[model samples]
Target: MPARPDRQSLPYRDCVGIAVFNQQGDVFIGRRKAEGDPEQSAELGAPWQMPQGGIDKGEDPLKAALRELHEETSISAVSLLAEAPEWIYYDLPDDALGIALKGKYRGQRQRWFAFAFTGKDDDIDVLNPGGGKHPAEFDAWRWEKLGRLPSLIVPFKRDAYDKVVEAFADIPRRFNLG
Candidate 1:
């Protein structure tokens, strides 16, 4: 029998994450769909998360962030606020090593972007995201405080979320976004 490859030996997937903040300084988050297994659910942790996804080959990071934000939330009325100065990364837990991320990546190396929501609440929709061209990644959605994001995400992803929060910490006051 062949030996299994070390999890750390796998490459990290290139990805982008978007945080959309409203006038109240709250950020958009969506409740992820349950993966349909009790054990998997426990391994995945909290369901709520900001919009994020893998980046396509040869795609610009900012472009990928906008596309993913629209694809996952059906939100388009937004103005760029800030982009993280560096990529943030997180690794999947051992139990999820070969199961999550299509078993191809050990984790994600993400570029994060913060945007100000410029449209009404009605403009946001999790169902029929991207006008149904993309499958829904979230089952429900809500606005949450920026600092609360790290706690709301899965354990393996908290570090990345924390870094994102830190990177954009000055946005609200700098932009007078309340």
Candidate 2:
């Protein structure tokens, strides 16, 4: 039998996350498409999350965040608010270690950006994001209170989401005021 590789030996994938805040201080979240068997999919309670994706080789983190946001949500009319003070990281749960992230990463280390959404609600479209150049990551999306994000995400990702919320805690409020 082959020996399993140590989880610690695996590296985290570099990624970027985007938090698009609407005029009312709510942030955008999307329901992720279910993966694997029904039983496993059912375990992911409230599977809502902000748009995020891998940093392509040699790509700048800010640009990657914009690209991911556009690819996943088709949102392009936004102004930068702030970037997380430092990278936030999270590990996949035990059951997803060899399956999630295509078995290449232990988890993801992310640089998160906050943006103020400027366009109308009619401008947003998750079904054909990036003009269908990219695969659909979200089945549905909506604006929600920033403080509620951690509770809405999957268990393993809550900590990372917490840090993201903390990092951008004031951006949304300040943006709304100005």
Candidate 3:
């Protein structure tokens, strides 16, 4: 059998993730659109995920998070609440090793941000780009309880989601929104 590639030989792509919370303390979650997914089949096992995307070459992670949020959900009425103190990473599953992310990355090293949604719910428009170069990532979206996040995303990404949940679990208390 061929020797397995070491992690160092497979660098992760730098990425950003967003957790947008509404006044009711619910967080935004989107149903990933698989229509033209290059890496996933039409029926990706996990259909739901939070807004996330790769950070541009020189873009700040926070900026990427906000941009991704708007690009994916058309919601720009958010204010930063907190940024994770450290970056966290997750490896792509074997099935995705050579097919996902254009095979340039082994997985993702992400910086997560929590933001409070200041606009009304009507601000969300997943099907239309409020103003973005990239196409939409989600076909539909809705507010969801933070605790339920991990279970909603792909298995390979669950741990990353769990870490995000832990990192921002104090949001309600810290922001006095609960």
Candidate 4:
């Protein structure tokens, strides 16, 4: 996908992901684990993905993404952009990561925002201090090189992540030297 010349308007249309970048220029990635995801048939047991959620009516994707990051990872280092933003899209795989969704939604179309993590790695907490259910799309995680994240993600989303990585190639140098 070439760069989108038009920016997304309000109501974002669908979901967005928070690409929480750190001082090392790495982005945060999380996992999901729900009742065995029996509904999933694709690589059902493979670890995949990061913090992402649907953008609500009248709600911005960045807000939703940050909320999801906190809800899923208990971190607030993420921050959205005002003008330029990193956006990407994808189609649902025939079986989706080799796991079946057991639902009607085809797949998520996303607008991802990149953030510089000014906090420490120990600050990331998916379980949170209160201990509630993590609204996750992954079960476990580790900071990865932004360029490499796409291939590690489900094959279905590799293209989308590739687009995002391309759009934000300079992301690492943004605030990484502190």
Model 2's TM-score against the true structure: 0.93
For candidate 3, the TM-score is 0.90
Work out the TM-score per prediction: 0.93, 0.93, 0.90, 0.75
TM-score-based ranking, best first?
Answer: 1, 2, 3, 4
- In model 3, which range of ten residues has the least summed lDDT? 1-10
Q: Which lDDT tens digits does candidate 2 get at residues 18-127?
A: 99999888999988877653312667577789999999999999999989999998899999989899999998887777667877788999999999999998878888
> Between 2 and 4, whose TM-score is larger?
2
lDDT: worst 10-residue window of model 2: 35-44
The digit string of per-residue lDDT tens for model 3 on 36-67 reads: 67454554477888888899999989889988
What lDDT would each prediction earn against the true structure? 0.88, 0.86, 0.84, 0.62
Kindly list the per-residue Cα lDDT of model 1 for residues 82-155, writing each as its tens digit. Answer: 99999999988877676678778888899999999999989888988988888888899999999998999988
> Which 10-residue window in model 1 sums to the lowest lDDT?
35-44
Q: State residue 98's C-alpha deviation in candidate 1, in Å.
A: 1.3
Task: Give the runs in model 1 whose Cα sits over 4 Å from its true position.
Answer: 1-4, 36-40
- Stretches > 4 Å off in candidate 2: 1-4, 35-40
Query: What lDDT is reached at residue 167 by model 3?
Result: 97
Best by lDDT: 1
